[model samples]
Target: MSALLRAEGVGKAYTLRGKRVDILRDVDLAVRGGEVTALVGHSGSGKTTLLHILGLLTPPDSGRVFVADTDTSGLADGALADLRRTRLGFVFQSYNLLPQHSALRNVVLPYTGRGADGERHARALLDRVGLAERAHHLPSELSGGEQQRVALARALINDPPVVLADEPTGNLDTRSEETLLGLFRELADEGRAVLLVTHNPAVSEAADRVHRLDAGALVAEGSAA
Candidate 1:
């Protein structure tokens, strides 16, 4: 499979109290369609920073990021925003749902210009995630797993080819984590490029490929299954 999101020799650093602190160094990786790629590391290892770069939320200080064949280094803020909205899906550990909105409404929020069938499509996605019956429930009324599933549905609202998830199973119980693990695999089966940053061993262990990072650099990588 080819990469939908590719990072090559990427590096990032931040200044703290007049001292440069590197967060990533000469990193190289790809998140390809039809696979679940897990990035694992301890806290402060820069896994989330790398994910942010790949997701176009942050720019690398060195090297390049490619969305499909498009080199992102030269794109302006507007172009980058367009690409991010149209080409990528994101899931977060906090679920990121609007507190007052119904699950159906939250799922449909990103489908700008929804036209006549937006709610229908959103309903279908909710059903796909096994939440059809709870479509009208507020985030406060749902379980953590349910809210995350709703976030997953929302992420798909734009029909993005690439999915980026940061610590997706971080807050779930074992059973819920397993359920999400299965869903991630099914996402691969449906041909979306799935890149997830996770600390949970179970989450990484279930992935098709695993990459390990240490002190902001890739230390090891291999097939996990």
Candidate 2:
């Protein structure tokens, strides 16, 4: 099967002060359907940079990103946005929820416009995340784990083919982290490509494959513990 998401010889850099600092170099990776792939690295090791590139939120300085065999490099910004909407779901460490919106509204916001069906779908997702009772609550009223679960529901709102998470469990306690990880595993089991960037040892151990990022490249690969 083809990779749902792939990066070939990908490179990224930033102008830090007067010099160009390389964040990723010659990075090649792929996430296939029915599997969870974990990218592990220390802080500032380009894990997030690579995730952004894969998500098409950032352009790579070199190399290419492919979504199911289509090179994203040739797509225009609007086209990229459309592809991202239909093909990719993203979860962030910060729980990037709209504080003003209720949990159900936040999940429905990803769709074009609000409708009865959309609300029903969003509510089902909230229920899946064990937040059905809190669907009407605002982000501030939810605990950290609840907020992250809401974010996860939002990510799946579109039923995309791939899910990319950056430090998804960074803020949760052990139980919450386990809950999120199980959801990720379920996503993979259902044939979605799940790629997550995490420094947490337990998260890495739960994946099907673990790739370590170091010195701007993929330094190692092994089966999960």
Candidate 3:
């Protein structure tokens, strides 16, 4: 099978203080269906930058990004937005939930205005993440772990082919981290590509492949074992 996501010679740079700062350089990466790929790196190592590029949230300076067999390099802004909304899921460390919205609403927001089964699908996802009971609770009323689980539910509501998580369990306790990791593994097993950026060793161990980024380059790639 073809890779669910692929990046070749990807490069990203920014200008700071009148100097060019390269965040990623000549990075070649691929995530096939039914695999969890962990990206491990310290702060400022460009893990988030790479994730954004992969997710189509940011365009790379020089590279080719293919998602589900479509090359995104030539897609217009509107086309890219449409592709991202329908084909990709994202989990972030911050949760990014609206404080006033209930967990169910938060999860369904992605499907809103799109005439999709926003509520029904969102509820099913919440059940999958073990958050069915807390579906009516607001973000502030839930614990960090609960919020993250809700985020996970929200991410899956679109039934995307790939999920990108950035520090997904960064603020959760050990048990919560384990729960999230389990969900990730399950997603991969179901043939969805799961790419996670994290510093947690436990997260790395759960992945089918782990990659290390240093100085804006991919320096290592290996299996958890």
Error of 1 at 42 (Å): 0.5
**Model 1 misplacement above 4 A:** none
How does each model score on TM-score?
0.98, 0.96, 0.96
Model 1, 1-225: lDDT tens per residue?
899999999999999999999999999998889999999999999999999999999999999999999999989999999888889999999999999899999998888555858899899999998999999999999999999999999998888999899999888888878888888889899998999999988888888899999999999989887
Tell me the tens digit of each residue's lDDT in model 3 across 1-225: 458998999999999999999999999999889999999989999999999999999999999899988999989999998888878999999999999999999999888345656788888899999989999999999999999999988888778889999999999999999999999999999999999999999999999999999989999998988
lDDT of 1 at 173: 88
Q: All models: lDDT?
A: 0.93, 0.92, 0.92
Question: Which parts of model 3 have CA positions greater than 4 angstroms off?
Answer: 112-116
